[model samples]
Target: MFLLVLLQVLQPAGAQFCPDLCVCSGGAAELRSVQCGGAGMSALPVNVPPDTVKLRLERTLISRVPRAAFYNLSELRFLWLSYNSVTSVHPSSFVNLKALRELRLDGNLLTSFPWEGLRDMPRLQTLGLNNNRLSSLPAHAALFLPNITYLDLSSNRLTILPAELLDLWFPLPELQKGPVRRKILGLHDNPWLCDCQLSMLTSLSSSLGSPVVLMDQLLMCSRSMAPSGMLLTRAELSRCTRPSVQPAATRVVSPLGSNVILRCDASGYPTPTLTWIRTSAYTDCCQQNLLQNSEQPPRILESFMQGSPRVGVRWSIITLNGLSYQDAGEYRCQARNMAGTSEAPIKLKVMGVTRLSRFPKRKPKKTPFKSSPKFRKPNQTLPEKESPFIFPPLKNKIQKV
Candidate 1:
């Protein structure tokens, strides 16, 4: 009895630390790795051994990561939660992962990440966020992930990236130094807008002694007047250009009490801001003279603007509601950027109201119907059709030996 009890105590300490539905591997005294997966897991496993160095929990139904989820796993070096349905993670979910070097959340449903949480993982080097639904990142995201050497952001809905982040990867001449290891940045398969910003990335990538490696895939951008699949390395994007406006129509005619939408699209590097100004000449001499003054500005009309940096395009629309004679004027869409400013004019003319007549509803006349002789009834039985190229049955010829 004493011998059996001693054997049970000496069996394995790592096995006892394993959480339910998880498999652990390590020496007899400590657990180093724990892996938990399958459709049955709906939440993160608790009570992971404090000494565990690696943990993988993938392909589960885990939708959210609660705060301090891994508070005790201080020695963890790698944590992968790929292919999960995780949509959100609390800012403090990675609280105690100080020694962590690699963290992967690929193939998740995350639309936004808590970049502030990176403070907890100070020693992290490799970060994987590929195959997610992220469309944008905060401007200051580069501050927290400064030391990251291997970054994966491919296959996301990213259209534009902050210049600060790009600067981090491709430092200025004065800031560049001999890196301990070559940095790898994966940015392909994104809808990058071909602007001066993207042009800077391409130019940096082509530098003779750059330390960063953009994966071996051509980065493409969406641009007006360009082919559907244009590569970013084109010479057109090599330099910054002034902003230019493309108006849908130069003149608009609308009836009184009706609404009309005037659209203006602008393109340039350093994405431009569009403004709508009501520049119609005023009747009062003082006002007209003031408007003519170069220093004086016209009245700015209320408008809606949307910009897609990924496509290097910004558009603005102003709606003239309840068009009246007083609303007739020339509106100017002024697009301004660091490069230069450009304007496009739209002239609106409102005419007297003309009433439209409503036609009365008419019902169809009922008529007696007869079936065509060529049409067959649903329940009618037809003669059997012969099969084409039918083979005849062979007779069994017995050969007497």
Candidate 2:
């Protein structure tokens, strides 16, 4: 009875299982390891031993993965489905593979990702989603697989990190508990925006005490360099990805109006946080009350003339209203997040509309009044203004008058 039960437990699904034509090996392996990769496989075989430990199906022509394909594989651990033409992964696929650990899905044409499918593998650690067309990593990605230490998400079309993804472990509260640390976050090949949206990534790199590795180097800017050129190196991406810092030199541009924006721009790791502090708080205290849009304004101002906040490639805008000379002073914009803090000083110079007196007015010189040609009468007889001319033409012409 014990020998019969052991044979039943070791048996694969279905009776007299024959290796499919898609797999190169003819199921001749007496053990569990199988090498079925690159045999023109369009779909997973219908019958295979549940105890198969290593399954290699890479570089095949498989397009769609069927649901319930990998169920009851209690012993399957390492699965390589990379370098295929897979477009979509059904959510029900890989639902029961509780022992799956390392899965590689790189170099595929996958446009949409099945987050639900991968999350089913609770014990998953290393996930490779590199070289795809994923634009955004959905929120709570880290939460689904908390044990994931090696994540490779390089070479995607992502313009910016998701807004809620302030940190790698932002979604998982336990991971954000300050003492926790991740081994690696492979975010290189993706087109990352070098703006404040990526401040968290930049700031975390400094705290990590090393440069965040992209594919070939560190970070590749989405907009900084040529598209087809070599990947950005660690040094080139250092300043670009670091959180913004305050500039030592301050510049003040005072414009005309009751409302003015004290513009602050600087560079550092973890993009600088902006906070406007009126140095002459008591003197221009009334003006502070007049400041409009006190509530958090949209991140960027649309008006071309208005100031914009400086992030990786651009600037951030802050508005101030009811300007006075007292409003002019050192106003600090403090930028802070989990990584670090950066304070940029904006020396406010309130430039109101130039009063006529304030502007040097030309003095109205007393012009000698000249009689108008229309109003003047011709002189009829100029009698003895001087002695009448005696000789008419002494040297040249005879007097015709």
Compared with the true structure, all predictions reach lDDT values of 0.77, 0.58
**Most lDDT-accurate candidate:** 1
lDDT of 1 by residue, 236-341 (tens): 7655655789999999977778999999999986678889998874333223323344334578977765656554578988877787566666889998764456
lDDT value, residue 51 of candidate 1: 73
Model 1 C-alpha lDDT versus the unseen true structure: 0.77
lDDT of 2 by residue, 73-141 (tens): 667788878888888888788878888888888888888777777767888888888988888777656
- TM-score, each model? 0.56, 0.50
Error of 1 at 239 (Å): 1.6
Model 1: how far residue 152 lies from native, Å: 0.4
All candidates: CA RMSD (Å):
30.4, 20.0
